[model samples]
Target: MTAVHYWRCFCGILMREVLRFVHQRERFLSALVRPLLWLFIFGAGFRQVLGVSITPPYETYILYEVYITPGLVAMIQLFNGMQSSLSMVYDREMGSMRTLLVSPLPRWYLLLCRLLAGVAVSIVQVYVFLAIAWAWGIEMPPLGYLAVLPALVVSGLMLGALGLLLSSAIKQLENFAGVMNFVIFPLFFTSTALYPLWRLRDASPLLADICALNPFTHAVELIRFALYLDFNTTALAAVAAATAVFLAAAFYGYDPARGFTRGKQTA
Candidate 1:
């Protein structure tokens, strides 16, 4: 196919996702609600309990709300990623995925388009959360707004690719929802999203090690630093590497000839 054909395919997939998001108003609301609750309610309750010392991202010590804002943002993207892949499972059962995959476009390109579309949607949700938080007095540096964009894109892609990988392995719609809970809760709680690694290390050294190794922790750290107009090189490298690994695994899983899709095809 020519460049025009590729462009058209990408646009078509993106618009469809956008339109789906628009019609499913609850999806948008739900995405915002979870993080907002964590920011306003949970953050407040824990404000006194959680003491965040000066970390790499912050010059001075910060409030619990301020410290967790980036984590909440990452949380939004995480949910959006899983929600996008949930749709993938639905499309597969409904046979829409097969139709799209059968198109002349390369399978990998098609999957990439789907991933980008999900990232675009997640970015919108993230900015809206930031705007609301800003109004709520949780402020970041002005330039941090601009600086965080690249971080968001990379983190979103990494998380969304992970969702894509999960979707490829899931065969039925019903089972995927259970798997989401199984995966999301562990990934969120075990990471440095709510608490820093040092704190976890204090509680249990082994738990701290797992949190350090968790890719989600790096994603949160990446956003946390970026929002303060700072950089975390280790976080950047870890997130980039995780993105590559997840995406490569997703591509392999979607391979109809030999991967998870093969069983579906045969059956």
Candidate 2:
């Protein structure tokens, strides 16, 4: 297809995703509620028990809520990304995904368009959560809001790519619940989301190493540093590499010759 045709397709797909999000008020509310509960309920409870030392990005001691704000932001994106993949599975079952695949456009490009759309939706949710956090007195540097956009986009893409990879593997809607339990909770809890790496180390060095190796941890760290207007080359590099690998695997998973689609056809 021509460039204009490609652009039109991309726009159409993105708009569809956005509209789907808009129509589903419960989805929006649930996304906001999950992290807010963590910030208000869990963080409040943990503040007294958890003593955070003066870390690099943090100048002095910080509240637990403040420390986990970025992680909550990342969490919003993480769940939204998986939700987008759930929609993909639904679309496949309903035959809409097949229709999308039958288009003349390259499969990878179509998938990328869908990925970008999901990322866009997740970014909006992140900012909304940030706004609520600001209202709740979880403050960051003023310019930090603007500075963190790139990190948000990268992190959103990484998580969304992971969702896409999962969608390609999960053939039926019935199987998704198992995948969510197996994948989402483990990734979130194991990462530096709810607690610091040091805390994990205190518990178990092996657990800390696993958290360090988690791509989601790097995504959270990238956001944390950006929110403080600081640069973390290591986190940035790790997230970038993870995004690349996840996207490649997702692309392969959707490939018709030997991927999920092939399995679907044979079955």
Candidate 3:
């Protein structure tokens, strides 16, 4: 009975997540377009100005669009992860999250279900972005492309869990945009998204170390290696460590005693 109930609850949560994105079709397209614009339009212009070195398997004058594809993919997952969690917070405001929370299943299971849904949706957007990149002359081996699916899933889970943690910590939706703008942009820019770590080292050693410590950097590296069908040990470890930390902190944040839901939870 426990197994039956868990599977059913998982399906329910997944369905709810899919419905939310499906109903807001424009949001998905907008998400895809924003990055593509950055890659095709902005990155193209910046490539001439920004100093970037040739990383392995990229032996010639590579376009910035080609270089940043992995990082851009990471960006999409991270943003979507946060967006999904923000939606969860909105659901709480509208009295829907309480419905899920008060269900017979464990809270962790429900949370995982939601996280998995976010991952599934993220993968779809990622592939769409990849197809666009391919057409734009940004080529990678076909197997390299297929192998990135798991990394994307892991990254989506980690970021989505962080979002869930943030949602649980904040009091209301009003504060989310500030958090998004102030928090997300800094994290993205500081990472190896626009350039490699060595490039940042030349810019400022302090800045380079900060980027090294950033979990998002590791996530970016993880995707970068997977895109090239290479494995980065440091990146895998970092993602794993971040996943553990975020999940723990998020679990604590969601605890009733922590006042995460406060007056928001009818449960």
- C-alpha lDDT score of every prediction, in listed order: 0.93, 0.93, 0.85
Report model 3's TM-score to 2 decimal places.
0.95
C-alpha positional error of residue 181 in candidate 1 after TM-score superposition, expressed in Å? 1.8
lDDT of 2: 0.93
Native-structure RMSD, model 3: 1.8
Any residue pairs clashing in model 3, and if so which? Answer: none
The worst-scoring run of ten residues by lDDT in candidate 1 lies at 258-267
The reply for model 1, stretches above 4 Å from the true place, is: 259-267
How do the residues 165-257 of candidate 3 rate in per-residue lDDT, one tens digit apiece? Answer: 888877789989998997689889999988888889988999999999999998898998888888888888889889888888888877766
lDDT of 1 by residue, 80-175 (tens): 889989999999888899888989999999999999999999999999999999999999999999999999999999999999999988988889
Tell me which of candidates 2 and 3 scores higher on lDDT.
2
- Pairs with backbone N, CA or C atoms under 3 Å apart (clashes), candidate 1: none
What's the CA RMSD of model 2 in angstroms? Answer: 1.3
- What candidate 2 gets wrong by more than 4 Å, as runs, is 262-267
